[model samples]
Target: MFKLPELDYEYGALSPAISADIMQLHHSKHHQTYVDKLNAALEKYPDLQNQPIEDLLQTLDELPEDIRTAVRNNGGGHYNHSLFWKVMTPGGSQPTTELLGKINQEYGDLETFKSNFTQAALGVFGSGWVWLLPDMSITTTPNQDSPISEGVVPLLGLDVWEHAYYLDYKNVRPDYIKAWWGVVNWSKVSELAQKS
Candidate 1:
């Protein structure tokens, strides 16, 4: 059975930017549901366990429609949330000088990078994610899908799902988007980029 990974930080660690209640629901309830359903889906197709993830994902579209939704939603949820948990850390420092220079190379300057990244994150029409992908690439995806599926290495992901911020920021998603940077783990981001 696939398991939901424990968070590196406490449920209340993010605070003001992301409240404890939201984290509790997002991680414990929402993410756990995905893990459970994903395990169920895989159990139904024992052969799928032997295929490469890429092959498995392609075949996902061909599964019976009833289970197709489950696999896509839950599988994507599992992948995206796992990546999300690894990329966040407590607020304290900015990106290191080396990482800042890379951001500058890709986005002109820190301010412009923030402006573009925030706008990309807030501009999504519905539930989705805004990502700062490896090597400073900024992108977004609908629902639970990952950028990795499309060939980009994800460095950071900001959840734009209302459940992520609705209780705290209410309908003002931009406020939540802006505040997410407070706890961004640029060091982890840099480490992932190097691996990429």
Candidate 2:
């Protein structure tokens, strides 16, 4: 069963970019719910432990009908949030030489990368995520669905669910997105990409 990891930083660490109230609820309440549901779903299918996650995903349609949506929603939620935590930090280091060079090559410059990622994030019609993914690549995804499901390794992600920002940023989501870069742990992303 999947569980929420202990946060590496304090709830208040991302402030004044993201408020303490927002971090507390997002991590303790919201992400915890996903972890709980994922545990329940896994308990319902004891035989799945030996399978690769990709194989299990492919067989999801064949599972007993009652557990399908639970597995999809909770399982996906667990997976996405785990990646999200690893990619975030209190305040991040600037990208290293190799990562910066790649960013420049791929998006022309850092400003363009932020602009494009922000636009794509805001373009999501509802509750979702804005991701910076890797697969000899950088890209985005929507909702709790993983970029890994499409063969891309995730380097960074931003939760776009209103619950993630409404109490702090109110309705000015773009401002929240702009503020997020300040707390983004680029070194974590570079490490993940290097592994990929």
Model 2 stretches with alpha carbons more than 4 Å out: 49-64, 136-139
Candidate 1 achieves a global lDDT of: 0.80
Per-residue lDDT of candidate 2, residues 78-101 (tens digit): 677777767778876677788888
Model 1 ranges off by over 4 Å: 49-66
Superposing all C-alpha atoms, what RMSD in Å does each candidate have to the true structure?
Answer: 2.3, 2.2
Question: What's the TM-score of every candidate structure?
Answer: 0.89, 0.89
Q: What tens digits encode model 1's per-residue C-alpha lDDT throughout 1-196?
A: 6788999999989887788898899999999998888888888777665554444445666676767777777887877888777777767346778778989998899899989989998799899988887668788999987776666667888889988889999989999977888878777877777787
Top candidate, metric lDDT: 1
Task: Give the Cα lDDT of each candidate.
Answer: 0.80, 0.76
Among all windows of 10 consecutive residues in model 1, the one with the lowest summed lDDT is 49-58
